[model samples]
Target chain A: MTPTIPILRVRGHLLVSVQGELGDDVVEQFQNDVLSAIERDRGRDGGLLVDISGLEVVDTYVARVLADTAAMARLMGRHTVVCGMRPEVAATLVQMGYMLDGVETALDVDDGLDRLGLPR
Target chain B: MDPSLTEVLQFDEHQLRTRLAFFRIGEEELDRLAAMRPLMEEATAQIVSLFYEHLLSQPETRDFLDDPVLVDRLQAKQTAYFLQLFEGRVDLAYVENRFRVGAAHERLGVPPRWYIGAFDRYLGLVRERLIGRGVAGAELVADLAAVERIMHFDAALAIDAYVAGHLATHARNQAALRELASPVIRVHDRVLLLPLVGTIDSFRAQQVMESALLGVSEEQARVLILDIAGVAVVDTQVADHLLKTTAALRLLGAKTILTGISPQVARTIVELGVDLKTLHTRNKLSDGLELALSLVGREITDKERGS
Candidate 1:
């Protein structure tokens, strides 16, 4: 059984930190939850921050999902920023040919929030 | 040279003797050894013969004796070595010879394990001969104890030399590999070239960042051309490292321009949906240089002044 990833809302912004290896189904479910949470909040100015700092390696599947989430968030008028991409993980991702298109990245959560310019 | 090897070479004969002084190997023992010269001479031939016979019996030992003539000569050399250990006076020549012997063993690819094991058999043979001499009681006990110290000290010197040589070779290879893998070269007055040639793992990636950054600061380079023509893969981890390196260079007031990203890498990045738009990139080194030159207010106008 896959543990559902929690998407927390702070100051109207949705923050989803992927903690471990997520199965494709779990990632898809998380994506749906994120979109639903954004709609429920009904705050178009608020953005989504997907943190992948906890991940050691983001495979081709994970990379695609992350990219799509960014695109979908944008479509919903939410800015998505990826935070805490480790140096080694980034290198491996690039080596594996992941450009992480449309995913704005920051060093950490604080940096992500700053980039998003959210209140409080 | 490796620091360990340098340390080993520094232990001269006087120092080594003093360090092993706990065994009470002094002038009195030398006198006793000289007094037993006849016994040493009488036992050497038989000891050498027995030593070779024992060595030849074991598959591990027989491998060292590749040529019959060479083995015969080594047996004679072994006889001299056995006699020299009990020859009264410990001199620089003795330690020097031991070092040469160690160097030879290293060349022969004879690991220390084999030689150290062989010492035990040599000591056993020597003990047998000492006992057969009928030199009994306290005298025999004292003589044998002294003989053990001499042999142990001998083994220490040889093994020390062997280890030193091995470490030196190992250090050399490590340095060579480091140079080949991570190089930060200055191509122009303010532009640096880092041509990554091998697979970039996390460790190498970190090293690349460190050395490249150091070069940036040291050379005061305005632009770093990261040429990955030789790099075969750029997994997410590798890409992350590249970005991190670029970010670091940015902090130092230097711009990082990536070049030589092949079609497969490009396809992989696009397929994975990685956004590399934030970085300044060019298809080739020449294109990157053109941009770098422009950044420094230098332009390459055609010499003919017309197409």
Candidate 2:
């Protein structure tokens, strides 16, 4: 059985840490969980920090979904930041023509949280 | 119609009949003479100059006819068309010839409004010129009536040609857009085959998305086999496009089977750290075809079936 990924919430920031192959199913679940957390914390200011350190290469679909999710969160008055995208993974995503337009990217989760103005 | 009359008008019997019906005038000598009046007015240098002056005064028409050489050629062509109207031959051959000329201009992207405006100005000049000559009574009215009929026919021809040209251009643009979206390949009832031939880019990826969606919607296809054997190399960009397209297909409830990944492409995908384990990819088109048939619950017999 595949190991369950962990989602840790610190204050108003939600941290999604996955340690396996990030496929379509995993991406769908991650998106749902993040949206649910944002809805649960509605009317309160918060942020989302997605840590993808375990992932080596992020596919085009997931990249697009991440960008879309970030946009959606921003529209709901929530700031979203993506962190720990490996150089190789970032290169792969760039080659795939995934526009990282609205989503903020950082070297690590700590930096990502800092960018969101949330205390680590 | 006499053979000489047909030769001069360059229209067959059927075309002449259609044109005569459009003019609402028969092959009678008086009606034929009346039709010549408009042509005579159009051929005169004074009326032609007046028509040009009016066209040049309008910015829209003036811009299109800015080239002096083109203007000269157009004037020469119009003069010839005018002379043909009074050739004393009312046949389908003459009408067809006129239609062909109008169609040629339409293909050249000349707007119908330009031809109509030019004819309108020509008519006004003819009316002024004839009235100033002290012409009156039924004779003058009959002459004017003939001129109007010929001009109206010419205008109709020009408009028809313009419409045909616009339709043709629209169809061509649609086809190009469709091709850009997806290289569509028709397959048998149980099969949906798409061959990837050239380089794939992001813009092409969107096109592929539209095309694949259309194929799935129209064919109700149970099996979609994408043949990439013709592709030269599978770069990361191309691979990403394929992955996105596959994901989109799945969302639309369509199953996509990729085929024709050369060994080099396999190595590249591995080197790039892209995972293809979730995808049903094959090395050959035939293997993909077999898989597609199995998904559709159909068998490929030894005998070839209709496409």
Candidate 3:
């Protein structure tokens, strides 16, 4: 059986839990899914929470896609909060010159939810 | 015409002419010029090696030396430059030639600062080498000083040309960046507001990331708001910038909020098919402001509130 994308709903916020390798292909699909959710909830007052706990390595391309996704959500009138980014992954993103110009990042899902003004 | 008088007069004339010509010629002149040749060659070679060694030791200059072809070309030019020093006459023509080479480097975008350090070290090496060769007399010192004087004159001209070219390039870049304003701003005591405006290309995106990182650290900001309201479009590239920024801000231990998304930007986000299901973003600047305030444990009334 093909592995399914793990998406959990918390307080009306879509939480996409990513794990393992976040390749360009996987990240592309992930970006599409997040965009779909934002569109579904357009004109709404909620946000999405992304948990990237399982990611070990993020290449320049994947890192860029993740940032772009957050920006796109903001345009959709929804907030994009990413949580559970590994320390190593974060370092790689920094070294690769990834710009998070206008994205929100939190330590964990709880912190991310809180930043989005969502209840635990 | 008189036998005794003619002989005496002819003899006197030849003697006077010979003595006058003799005064014009010096016996030690040829020997002195010849003796300086070997010393000049030795000093030139030593200076070249020392220059290369100093350049290789520097990280910035080392890259320029990585290519074997380029290294060889540079070494050859440097050797030629040294040899030209002792070519007997130090005239305006020689100075002009050196100046032309230096100006060429300036046009080629070579910085003058590196040349100063390299030239200084080269002189020190020449002194050390000369000292080892048992050449410590006042005459030797004078010769070395002359060489240094010529080099300094050439170096100054090169640096001036380089500075002019550098300023021109800087002016152009400044003009471009000025339109974008400062990518970063300090809003609140512990908060930084980086309102990313215009279409952010990859290079500009990197600048934004670096600016944000540096601004946060230098400003000791606890909260960072990436205000994107003025951002006209949000394609995949834009989305990628947001993700990278978010990831980076989290690492820096600063809370980040993405604010300002217009309706047109929203449609682009959907059309591009990017997933931002798990990121914090706000439709308006005020929404982000509220979130930033909460992070700092501050609340605002209706005046600062936005729907």
Top candidate, metric DockQ: 3
lDDT of 2 by residue, B7-28 (tens): 4334466665677677865555
For model 1, how does the per-residue alpha-carbon lDDT over B46-159 read when each residue is reduced to its tens digit? 888988899899999798787999998898788788889878877767777777788779878998988988999998998898898887999998888878877887787788
For lDDT, the strongest prediction is: 1
Write model 3 residue lDDT over B1-307, tens digit each, in one string.
3243223223344543353244332233323333556776866766786688889989988876788888888888888776664564443445445555665677755667777878788777766765676767886665465546545655754564466556767989876885465467777877789998777777667667767766775776668899887766777777667667765766655767878877776676666665566456788888888888877788777675583
Give candidate 2 regions above 4 Å deviation. A1-120, B1-12, B28-43, B184-307
| Location of the lowest summed lDDT over 10 successive residues in candidate 1 chain B | B1-10
Q: What fraction of the correct interface contacts does each predicted structure contain?
A: 0.00, 0.00, 0.20
Q: Where does candidate 1 stray beyond 4 Å?
A: A1-120, B1-8, B184-192, B197-222, B227-254, B258-307
Candidate 2: C-alpha lDDT: 0.68
RMSD of 1: 13.3
* lDDT score for candidate 1 against the true structure: 0.78
Sort the predicted structures by DockQ, highest score first.
3, 1, 2
